[model samples]
Every structure is written in structure tokens, then in C-alpha cells.
Target: MTSATLHGYLEQSARRSPGTCAAVEASSGRQITYGEIDRLSSRVGDHLRRIGVRPADRVGICLPKSIASLAVLFGILKVGAAYVPVDSLAPPARNAFIFNDCGVRAIFVEASRAENLRYELARLAAEPRLLPLDWSDASSPLATYLARVEPEGGLTVEDESARPGPDSLAYVLYTSGSTGQPKGVMLTHRNGSSYVDWCSEILAPDESDRFSSHAPFHFDLSILDIFVPLKHGATVFLIGEELGKNPTRMASVIAERRLTIWYSTPSVLTLLVEHGSLDARDDHALRFILFAGEVFPVKHLRRLKAVVPRARYLNLYGPTETNVCTYYEIPQTIAEDRSAPFPIGRACSHVKARVIDANGRDVPRGQEGQLAISGAPVMLGYWNMPERTSAAFHVNSSGRWYRTGDVVIEDGDGVYTFRGRRDRMVKRRGYRIELGEIETALYRHPAISEVAAIARSEEAGVSIKVFYASRDGHALSLIDLKRFCAHNLPAYMAPDWFSHQQLLPKTSTDKIDYQHLMRME
Candidate 1:
């Protein structure tokens, strides 16, 4: 109902519902009212100013998903600085690479994540500077850290006087990298706010709604989780860490807290069902179960419907470059559409999507091609790679289209179905990955000869399947391969299934035939 920027939205909410719960970390049983968040974020912003973090200086934040993370994000924006949210669980090298690539002026990290953060920073061949934020206490570690970084409180004259440009970078999110190197996507305030507006309206929940956030803070999905409730005067349930890690604890949370709306990937949902917690004993209060970041398994969707008869099940589709574009809302009272592959649904207002052939021409209805999305939500592109940014961010020959590399087919009904990626992309449990990126990591191993990674979807959701041509033919066991992957890559990016192969399928150009490898599994 509000057509405002993210800052405006939060400012308005704080004005109206000063005492209403703005954010909470269920893991620590801590809460921050909207007014408190406003005050704290501004104070943190003041601290940043005292330390000389000027407008648009990249400030890196690597923290657990909690009240502190949210504060860091808003606080960075308040000073007109852009935030680079690094997933705390990300591999140490990945964190270091992103920080170095973005030229982060300062870094705030949780104490638990400090060991890896420092290791990666030290490993960097370039500037090894790292500003660490220890989050062992305080509502948000950044809040207290900023307090120390700048002793004199109160917003500086420049901080209070400067205005935020609509096109200025709001935040940067580093998603799965195809080159085994994550890419930093710069999102402007307009892009982020427009997406926030679209979601708040489409979901259409008022203050009575309680949205649960299960996605990691760095993921774009978390944007909706953090902003939607604030955009509407509603409460957000930040699931505890133990609950996030252990399925059993989450079950108890659902029954005990009576959460109203839920957002997560299929992997987490499948875990809930597998653990035998998808029963009436759970809170019937969960009114909606929304899935995105990857494809949803219809069978699991069906199973979910059987348990929560009143919940609305929605399939949200979009890449990090753009917020959600298409959504399919299937109320739990209705059975799943298992007959035809579910449509990705229609684009939201200000968003337009088309299926185009290889040359970028529109395909006929019902034909398969790449997806091109045009709208305010189009990302500003990779932070520093101009050539890459130019190739991915395009001005349509017709002058108004940004192409998304997703291969999909458009139906006569104007809906789209995901075919696969035209690039080295893989979506597992709502996370987009680049197999080349994994291969890059594997090649780093002196013991590995050659390797390729791909995603395999199963009843258990999605797991990475890796194939290798080892140098010694020493019977690279799954355990060993996995151990190597864990040592060098993030857990989510690790290949779950390892297979030994003498050679891999190749095309006429001698390139790896990913399609053929997908068939062997």
C-alpha cells in the first residue's frame, strides 16, 4: 500500500509502531522494537560517520542471521554507504575474495566467524586489512562495535545533511559463482525498494501476520523476509540458530510459537517432512509456506498440503539480479497441480518477462528459450567486472530489456517453466551455483586432475553431484572427495555425490557436455 523507498518504509513504520516488535533473534531470545531499531541504526550510522565511512564506501558484514545483521544493513545505508553482506557460513576464501574484490572500507564479522574471516584476509595476496566486529554480546555486534569505532555519538553534520540517491547502491549480494569466484551484485535503492513494494502488496498481509525468516541473511530471499513485515506493520519471527540447524528444534518452535507465515527453500521443507514433523501436532497457525531460490518438488508440496490444510503454498521465482518476478499461490486447502509442470506465473507490476531464443529474439508461445526480465528490479550489475557487467546487463535492441540467463519456456497461458541454465548454473535448494566455480576449487587441489559439478534433484530435495578424473586412479572415495570439498569450499557448494570417471562427455568443440553428464546420473 506504500510506494516508498526501504528507508522511508522503515521510518514510517517506526513512527507509527514505535513499540511494536521490529526484529528479534529467537536464538538469543532478544527483541528490538521498531523505535529501538531506528535509534540503534542511526546511532551506528553516527559511529560510522565519526570513523569516516563516507557515502558509498563498501562496508562488509559477515554475521549470523540475527537482529545484529539487520542493524548492520540499515545502519550502513543510513550513512549512504553500501553494505556487502557476506554469508558467515561461506568458505573463508570466498569471504576474503568478496571483501578484496569489493574494496570494502571496513568489515564487521561475528566472533564465531572471525577465525575463517581472518584466515582468508591473511591469505589475500593484496591488502590484508580487515575490520572485525565481535558479536558475542549486544543486540547487534555492529551496534556496539560502531559505538567503539566512533566514540563521539550523534550524527555528524555531513551524515545528517547528505541525501541518498535513488540510483545509489543500496547493498551488494555475492551469489554462487560460475568461475568458482562469487560475483558481487550491486542493487540500487530503487531496485531494492521496488521489490519490497511488490512483495508487500502481493503477499498482502497486515500487522496480524507473523512472517518467519529461514533463509540466510545474505540471500536475496532474505530481503523479503526482512522488509515485508516492516513494510506492513507486522512481526517477523527470526528462527533460532539451533532451530535453523536442527530440524527437531524447528518443529518445537512451530508448535510453541505458532508462526503464521513461512519462507524457506525446498530442502528445509523436505527436511521438515522427513523428520516426521509435518503433522497436525504442529501449529496450524502457519498460514503460508513460500518456496523460492530453486524449483519446488510437487510430491513434497503435496505432502505439505496434507499436513497444513489451511496454509497457502506459493512458488516464488526470481534470480538475485531481480527480486521475485513470478509467483504461484496454491492454498493448502487445494491440492497441488501435479499434472502439468507448475507455471512460474506472471510477472509483477513494473516487471516484464519474455522467453527469447539464443539470438535474443522472442520465441513463439510454448517455445523454450532464455528469460529476459525488464524493470526497476534489474540489478546494477557486478561491482567491478565491467566486461562481465556489460555482457550480462544489456539494453535490448528495442532499448528496454535486461536478459536473465535462465533457460525457460513460455506457455500459451503466458506463464514460464524453468528449463535449465544457458550458462554453467545450477539451482540446488533455492541457491544458484556455477559448476565452473566448483571445478575451479577442485582444480586447486594438487590431487585432482579434472572435475565438474552439477545439481541432482531428489525426493530429499537437491544435492550436488560431482564427477572427477583423478590423476592416480586411487579410488577417490566419496568421503575423501567430500572432505576435500569441505576443506576448500563452502558446505552448500560442496558436491554431495562423487563419481570417478576416466573421461567426460564432450561436444564438437571439446567442451564438457553438462547435459550428457546430467543424463548419466
Candidate 2:
């Protein structure tokens, strides 16, 4: 039978092709078939139920990306529970905050990481059951844990009444909040399935297709990487944390596995192109190179297209609240002199988008305004934070629309070009300026690899500070950078100060850590 929930996708695929390879460990070349994953997840679901986890309960997943983690994710959904994945690399104190905030019933974690998490949770007086994913230590042996928890003969029949529907909660993704705490964004099965359906219609993956899982489990991008491939009985190569950081190893895996579709942030794709030695590798199987999370420099994109001219490049744009609302397919040929960033194309077929002014009125074409999205892909709301959730959307006669907080100008043809974040625009010397615009101009310089522009307020006035990393660890002359900025940007928009680093700091999800830079003295 066809199913609407995320885990049901795996079930359907398993029934259709039981023996087909479902997932592969990129590091070890170990593979798991669809039937195997389905059965393992069922046993996991039985264990969760036996341990008193009820439908609609919240469960935490704190293990790194691996085949076992994927099974646990499906298992949570199988029992009609939403999984909350925390960054395994993050400190236990931070992970404890999320567990306490969400009030998770239980957490699936590796034994090595569980000690720290257990201590932090105890310190917070939050006692959630911790189920170890692996039993490496002598104290927690796999044999003993399995004998106690493993189901007899493995559960094959699912409790249909306990299965979640389209509107049931699927997962909660926590994002950095303005109040210096992480806020949980609640998403339903419908929220995930709608986007997955839209992508399946567009990409049309068959059972033979091989997709790359590059994004971390906690990131929103993983929604597409894990679910889309499973829905079509395709293979997903799980890129572990170590393998994800090494560009050469990643490139080799892509070539060896013959990955057809790749989805990740622009930063990762840029790293592969620059340092992965793709020019000498055989990666002709790549059909689609989809990127989001941050702007892609046109110069760098042009170079990537030159390297893999056969694949289609798409720029997907959206925030964590909405999975992906708008997308633009890059033209095969980009003029070498083109410097401006590409437009975030019109809204997806599953969603409706509007450019609204500050007063919540629709802005005319060619005017700058906030982009609002309303439709299937939009999230339910922030978990238990009704006041903040209400403020995040604009309600009207038509429907509730999510205010993206991104400032964009819609062209006459309806394509939207990102100007900057509403919070990133500042007034200096009586002139309004977009710090992202300044960063975009600086990226045109061949010497710059990564860049971030931040505005600071001082007793005297607002000052713009630019931080950048030069290509190949080469030192960039401040005078040369200032001269280039003056030529490309307006005098008022020019950065007042410039600083260089061998490499810019990145967040856990691999995006440039602008907040960290802002905190720098």
C-alpha cells in the first residue's frame, strides 16, 4: 500500500525491491539492502514501544551519520514518534539544552558520547533514557544490550493503528535563536512528503540511481538526501564526518560509487572543485549538482561548470522554516566577465511566494521586499513557542505566510535576487547599505576564497568590517582589496576595515560562522 509518512517511503521501497541496496557506508563500502533496513528498523520500533515510548513522543538521536543512525531514524517514525537529531560533534551541554527544551522521552547515542550527555542531563536534572547505538566499551557490550532489547524473531508486522499520518509530527530541527538559545522548528510528515514528492517528480530517480548524503543529519538538507533516495529504492552513500571533511576522499567516493545526484551547501561544492582534484577524476555520472544554504560566487560556479559541463547546476533558496521554496537552474554557459549572483528563481510548484513590504502589502515588481512563502513545504511552527511562531508569519484572507526575513528584489520576469538579510542591512553615513552586496563584490576578486562582511555600531558611528580568507593561504594586500572594493562598490558601501585569515571559521553544518566573526574583537 502507498504511504504518506516519511518512514512509509522506505517500507514501500522495501516491498518493491527487497534485495536492492538501500545504503552504503562510504568509508568501508559496506552495503545494506532495503529489506534488511526495513526489518532492523521494525525491531528498533518494537524496542522503543516496549520501553514505554508512545505515539507523538519525542526521541533524540545523538550518533554520528551511519547506517545504524538511519535505521534508528526510521524506527522512531515507525513508532509514530518524531526524532530530534543533535550534532554529535557539539558539546554535551549544548545537546542537553535541546533534550531538556524538547523533553525527549529517550535518546539513541553512541556509548562513547553517552557518558558526557548523561552527565550533562543529570546536571540539568533532566533524566531521559539513553539507548546506546554501539556497545564498544567493556561496560556496555553489544551482546548484552542486544539480548535484553532485541525483539524475538524480529518484528515484521507493523501496528497500523499506531502509524502516523500526513499531519503527524515527523521531526523537530533546532536552529540558532536570536535570544542565544536554540529554538525547535516542528515539521510534520506532510511537510516532508510534499517536498519529497515535488523533488521526485523533478528528478525522476529510478532504482539504479545513487545519491550522495553529504549534509549532516541535523541540517535540513538531509531531509532530501535521505528520504528522496529511499522513496525510489535508490542507494545513498553515507558520508561520515571524517570523510565529509576530506575533499580528496569524497571525490574518490563519488567516482567509485558513480553518484548521480548531489545536494549540499555551496561551500562544500566549492571545496571539492578547488581542492578535490576533480579535473583529473572521472565523475561523469553526476547528473544534478544542487546547492543552497549560502550564495555561490559566480566566478567559482563558472569554474565548476567548466569542470563538469555535463551536469545541471541548480541554485535552491530557502530558510530552515521552509525546506526549499525557490530554485534556479543555471544556464550551461556563463560569460567569464559575469560577476553578479544568480537569481533565486520563482516559487516551487508546491508553494506560493510573495514579495511584501514592511506594512505586509505586496510590493510591485522590481522593488525590494521580504519574500513570504505559504504552502505544503512550510513548517508547522516553533515547538511550544506560540508567541514567536505567530510573529514569524503574516496571516491574511488567503492563508498564513512565513516571513523569510530575507530581503529580495523581484525582477519583471518574477525571478527574485537576494539583496541581503533584513537584519544584515544597515545605515552608515546616512546611506543604506547591504553588507552582503559588499561581500559579493569582494568575491569577484580572484584572490579571495571566503568572505564575510559585518556591520558594528560604535559610539562614533556604524562601521563595516570585512573578514576574508585568501586563496591557497596567500597573503592578500589590504590596499589591493580596498582598491578593488572601491572600484566595484559605492563609496558608502565600501568596508571601513579589512582583516584576513588563512581560513574562515565554519559552523557545524559547514556554513561560514558570521556570528562567531561578529563576536571577534
Candidate 3:
């Protein structure tokens, strides 16, 4: 009777609307209905089970966005196995580390990326079975491979009684670790289903809604884009890699396809507003514009709002360890207030968040302290790192809490606003400076298109350096930036060195590559 797992919702929706379209490829004009998804995923699931994929086993998926990829994702879950999404665009060494760390039973990859996988797999001690799914250039089709593993008509439903419980692992998302390697965050069926259930209640997507899947599967934000739509029998319109990189084209696709739900990082939305010609689109049916991953610059957000005119904006905040613990509805009243960053808002219906001081005690309203969260959305903990997991969580009178490294301020109204990372706070010139505050101020400037702030050690002491991308091809000199900073920021906060780059480097997840930027200067 209970539908607390992600696959449970998928099966429920499929039974409710079998003929409804579940996914569409924008570039190819191809669409797959829920009935088709149920069948194909069943087929894939049979294939996986025949190849020794059992309940609680770990599988890795490193394919691009497509109907095949979605089928594999559900198929892994259908067999009660947890999947690890490997970033196809990441370096081979990084992928190898994830493979060795998780000890995945098998990897579902595309033939196009076979060479890359082979290179990474060579370095690993444990050899996982490679199930390549690309048959574009092959003489045969995927059915040929399926027949090898599964017997005729073996795609029938598995034993429903064997379905994983809420506590069973559903997926493992790897995030950039402080030690430079990636750490896998283990999430159970209950953890992911809790987030999906919360989203279903708040931002419900009916069959009429066409959700845009902009973020890659490797990114946690893509969870809402993928699962939320599938649960409601809505269509998921995949934005290709080329279009995701070009915001202007992405806007055109949104208008052309009449995508109803838009979810992506604030940086991607900012790019769309500045260069995506969103205002020129005539048929942009976007009703909900959900942004997260990083803070949105107010200036860029205002411009985007003008273009959509009627869309509702929601700021979603959470780390990979906790998926969307807090959300803030952007009220029109705050459009005029630009002095402080937007609030991360209150916790979701199923999440509990509190601001705690350094001593692990709760802080009074309006005081800056570390943000902590507990509840259904929290992860099971870091994979295979008990010491690190123990250090990350703290038990108090209320409940066990996962300590978020982020520092936030909670107003008397219970709204939480992000300050900066606790580690990012540095002392320079006998004054404490937050690098994020500097980056936020620099974003307000007209000339700087994108910026990243870092603290560098110098002979005199520590100095601030900013690597910025210019909007006008380096028209603004370092003196011009210095003068602007002098007017807007404190003496210690202003960067002593300004490095100009054509574009800010980005990680595979599309976040600013601050680590790489720090090495530039």
C-alpha cells in the first residue's frame, strides 16, 4: 500500500496513464510514452538481472541524456539495485576512482564512450562487466545484446514482493571531496522518495507540463528534472549538451517546445537572461522557474523575471548530502531590496534546519551561524568513510544532524539567508573578509560578466585575487575594476590582483571551477 520508493511512483504513474508521453528528445523529435518506458525498462532490468545484478548491488551509468539512459536508470532501480551516475565528461582518472571506490557490479555505458571507459577500467583492480548500449553504427540492435542475457519473454515483471524497502540504497551521488577525490553520498529509497514526494506536493507537474532536463544526470539538481516529471506522467524534454552550453539556443528550444517547468542552476539562468534572447521568445510557457546550486545575482534575476513576466520563481537550496532541504519563494516585494543576497528560506515540509553557533548550541534569530539539517532528505552518509561521516554529523537534544559547512543567518521570521562557507572566511590585512561577499559585489558591476574570488598567500600576508570574465572583451582595465571595487567594497575586501579570462572555467557539474581558477594566478 505504501509508495515510498522512486520506482513505486514510476509504476503507479505508468498504470495511471500508460499512453502518456514520458520522455522526448528535443533534437531528434523522438518521444516515448509511459507504456513504452515500462516495457523497455523491464527488458533492460531482465538483461541486468541475468548478468548478475542483484538487490543492493551497485551499478554505474555513464551515458548521455537519451531515452536509453532513462530506461537504464529505472531498470537499475527496478531490480532493487542502486546506481551511481558517472560524469561522462569528467576525466578518465576521476571516473576510475569512482569505479574502484564503489566496486560497482557492472557499468551501463554507450559504445561511443567505450574507448574512454576502457582507459579508466584498465586502471581498476576489479573488472566490472561493461554493458555497452550504443548500436547506432553497429550492424545489429540492442535487442541482440538483450537476447544474449535474457530468455525469450523474460522482460515480464520481476517479483514485486522482492522490491526494496524505503531504507534500501537507491543511488550514490559523488561530490567533489576536500581531498580532491570524489566522495559518494549514499541515498536510500526513502531519502530520494521523500524529496520526490515533497516536490510532488509543492511543484506538482501534471501530464500537461513539459519539464526541461537541463542539468546532467551527474548533478543532483537533475533529480527533480528527471523523477518529478516521470512521477506525474508529464513529458521530460531533454536539453542536449550543445544547447546547454549555449543559453540563447536553449531559450529558443524552451519557447519552441513550450517547456512548462524550468529548473537549473542560477548561473545557467543568468546566462539565459544576459545572452539567451528570452525576451524575444513569443511562446515561452514556463510557469515555474526553479533555480539552485548557487546564489542568483539579483540584477540577473530581475532581468529574467521581466522576460517571463508571469512565471513563479523559487530558490531551492541544499547540498548533495541533502536534496532541497529549504526553498524560498521570490516575493515581488523583495524585488526592490538588493542590499543582501536572497534568503534560502525555510525548511521543506519534511526537513528540519537550524542555525547553530560554533559551540553546537542553537543561535538566536538574526545571528550568523552554521546551518544544520535533519530529516528524510538527509543521506545515509559518505560511502565507506565512517570517520568522515561521524565527523560530519552531530547528535543533540532535537535529533541527529548533518552539519552543512555553509554559514547562514536566520531572521526573526524564520527565513534563512546564506552568508558564506565557513572555510571561505579568511583574514587579510588584519580584517576578516568573505570571498563570496566579494564575488557577490563584483557581480553587481556592469563590466564583469563572471567572477571568482580567492585568497592567495603573499610575502606581506594574504591577499585577495579575483578572476573575472569580461562582458566587453576586456574593455574595463584593472584600474577601472579597482576604482569600482573601491566604491562598492571595503579596502581589505577589494582584490589586489584582477586576472582576466575569456570565460571562467567550470567543473563537469557546471559550477565555477574555483579550484582551477585558484591555480591560474
Candidate 4:
């Protein structure tokens, strides 16, 4: 049977291979099979229905990455309610904003974090029913909570009238807004399933494949990590927050568990290559390594290729508004001294990409312009912000297209290389400067582990400031660093200030926190 909704993937997998492992916890060595996932999630859905969570209602999930969380997610979908996942590590106020913004009727959270979240929601005059996954009492555990809900007969029926359709809202992902608060990007079942179908076709993993779920559930990267495996009856290993930050532990998990397909940001992969000690371990089981969210420095990618030569490397590109619209597969061999970052590649099979100038006209190949995406994977719109949503897209005779807000150049070969963000370009002393270009050049240096270039407004003009972390904890001489930058970059593009730290602050998704860097003295 063809599954119309995202949860239907799990139902299909369970029916085909009920005993096959669906998910495994790296820290606890716990595993859950497809049959169990189906049954458990059905119970969750039944409970939601009992609690008056009707179709199209929003349900909040504020727990850590675990089998239970995955079950809760599917259960919410099973009952035709959209799930709103907040970063468990984020402050209660931020989570409260998301809950209130989406108007979630109930929240499933861990006991330890529930009180603060409840308090914050109350202060906002928003009261969502709180269901703790684990109780504080000595006798109650997660199982105890599940025991309270009676399981339905089985997975929800395939009748279109009884469940959500492909166009129904599946989840609401909150991303950093230009304003102080975060805004929700609403994605429907069709939006998710289209990307999942494309990936399943491209990767073609069988039941034996093991996928690494490294990204947090709230992040868009987790969409592929969690669903692609489920669609093909493969196992997904959940990497916890603490373990995700530890390079050594991450390396061990990959090699020990034999994770077949690994997906994460280049920053995390860079850490693994620099400190994971990959050369010493036998990681022959890995078949595909995928990265997205940020550009992968060519130099660092070269090092990773040397260690895991057998695996196919792919660079997936997109924002939360368009989930993985384009991808570039690294060639078998790159020049040993390649310094330029690789292109984000062509659009995905299900998506169409266009480069348009400021005047809304299509730019010629080799000309820089803003990238626009229109396809199955394109999001429905921003939640409840019609004006913002209207401004985000450009409607014409062809169709409505979401403006990616990313600048790129299309080559003769039909590949799109990321230039920089539209807003990241700064005019300094009559010359336009791209901060990402400076950061790209600095990444070529062997001593620099991670770097970010910021544009600052000073009395004289807009000056560029560079913040970097060295491979070794010790700081490098400013003279030498400046000399290196001078040799690689034009005089007008050189930075005015440099700051060195043992490590740059990272956001919950593991990307460098530029906002935090800007706030630092």
C-alpha cells in the first residue's frame, strides 16, 4: 500500500519487517523494533485523541533525543496533529514562545525541564497540558507513563477521511528570526515525504544499513536522519547531546556501531576528522557520508576523504524553508592543495532552482544572484505570519517561489556555488566584502580549526573582525595570521581585527554561533 502521510512510512516498514530494529540509543545500548514502534506510537496517538488533541491541533515535544521522543513524534502524526519540537537545551522562555506561537494544546516533556517550561508558559498566559515522560517519584519511569495509555488495535487505517493527507501539516520547525523571537516554518506531509522519497531513491539503503541521527530533532537535518532509515527499514542510532559534542566518543560510536550513513554539519565532521582519530580505527562499514547546513572547506574535506575513502561523500544544501533542495557529491579525488570551497551542486530531482537578480529577472550563468526554489519540498509558509510569508516568496506566471535569501553563482556546468548570504554582504570603504569568502580563505590554513568573519560598524566605516580557534589551544601570532590572509585575499577584503579563542561558541545545531561572537567583548 502507498502511504500518503509521513507516519505511514513507519506503518509500511513495520508491516514489511516487524522485527527489524528501527531505532537504537548509543548511550544506553537500547533498541526498539519496527513493530514495537508502531504499537507504541499508536498508543501515543490514542492518548492524544483521548486528551482532545484533534486533527490540525499542535502538540509540543520538549524531550531529549530518544526512542520515546521518536515514538511521540510519530504518534502525534498518527493522530493527524502537527508536532512542534523545541530545543531541549534552549531556555524555557524560548520554548514557551514556540508553544504559544503555535498554540500547542499539550506538551510532552521530561520531568526535570517541565516545571520551568510550565512556569514560563503560565506567565505568558498560555496553558498547555504537560505530560511528563519520566516522573520524579521513585517508582515511576517512562514505561509507567506509557502504561497509562491503552494501545489502539494497530496502526491507523489508510482511509483518507480518517487521517491527515499529504497536504496536512506535519510539523512546525522554529528557526532564528531576524527579530528577537524565533519564527515557525510550517512543513506539510507532502513537503517532508517528497524529500524523503528522493533520498530513499538516491541512497537505496536496505534493511542492513545503519544511519546516524546526529542532528537534534528540531533541526531540518534530522528529517533525513530519522525518516530515510524508517522508509527503508534501516536502523537509526540516536546520538545524545553530550556524546555529540565529544569527538572521541562520536568516533567510537561510528566505528563500533558501524554506522553506514552519516549526516551532519561540516563543523561536526571537521571536529571528527581533526580529533576523532579516524585513521587508527577500521571504519570500513561506512558507505555514505553526507553534510549540510554550512559549506565544507575543501581542505578539511580532503582530510576526511583520505581516512574514509570507500564511502561516498555528499554535500546537501538548503535552509529549513526548503529541505535539501540541492546536493553535491564529492569526486573520488580532489587536488591535494585545493583551497576553494566546493559548489552546493545542482538542485534535487524534485526541486527546481533559479538564480534571479535584484530586478527579479533570471541571471545568466556565471552571474551572481539570489537563489530561489520552487518544488515539492518547498514549505507551505511561515506559521500565522501572512505578511512575512507573502514577502518571502515571489509569485509569477510560472509559480510561487520561495526566496532562499542566499547568494550563489551558477557555472556553465549547471552547478550552483554558494557566494554568501544576501544580508552578509557589507560595503566597506567603497568595496563590497563577503565575510564567508574571508572565512573560506582562512579555513585553508592548517593551524586554524574554525573561523567566522563578522562585519562591524566603527566610527570610520564598517570594519571586518575575524574570530578563530587554533588547532592547538595556543594562539598563533597575529602577524603571521594577517600575513596569510593578506596573501590569499585582496587588500580591500582583509580584516581589521582578530580574536582568538580556545573554541568558538556553537549553537544547539552545532553551527558556529555568530550572534554570540558579535556579543563577545
Q: Candidate 2: which stretches are off by over 4 Å?
A: 135-148, 151-162
Scanning candidate 3 in windows of ten residues, the lowest lDDT window is 137-146
Candidate 2 vs 3: which has more TM-score: 2
Q: Looking at model 4, which ten-residue stretch has the lowest summed lDDT?
A: 150-159
| Residue 462 lDDT, candidate 3, scale 0-100 | 92
Residues 1-521, model 1: lDDT tens digits: 56335666777889999999887676666888989888878876766676678887888888777787787778888888888887676577878889988888777777777777777777775453355666655555666666666655544777445567778788898875666567998999889888888876767888888788777767788888887888787888787444675676776666666777888876577557655465747456887788886555455566667777777788888888887888877643434334233567777776888777766777888877788888888898888888888787547665556667877777777777776567657677677776655766676555555566787778987777888776575657667677878997887787878888875554221235566788896
Residues 306-357 of candidate 2 have per-residue lDDT tens digits of 8888999889998989998999999989987888899999788899999998
Q: Clash totals for all models, in order?
A: 3, 0, 0, 0
Alpha-carbon lDDT, every model: 0.73, 0.88, 0.84, 0.90
Cα lDDT tens digits, model 3, 1-521, are 23778888778888999999999877677788898888888788887777778889999988777777788888899889998998877776788789779989998877777777777778776588888876575433354556565654433446677778899999999998867878999999899888988998888678899999988888899888888998888999987667788987888888989999999988899888878888888667899999999888787888788788788999999999998999999975544558466889988998999889777899888889999999998999999999989888888888889999999999888889999988789998689888999988888887778888988888989988888888876756767898889999988787888888888888777788878977785
- Residue pairs of candidate 4 with colliding backbone atoms: none
Model 1 residue 151 CA deviation (Å) reads 3.3
Task: Give the worst 10-residue stretch by lDDT in candidate 2.
Answer: 135-144
Candidate 4, superposed: residue stretches over 4 Å from native: 135-141, 149-162
- Rank candidates, lDDT, best first: 4, 2, 3, 1
Off by over 4 Å in 3: 138-162, 333-339
Q: What is the C-alpha local distance difference test score of candidate 4?
A: 0.90
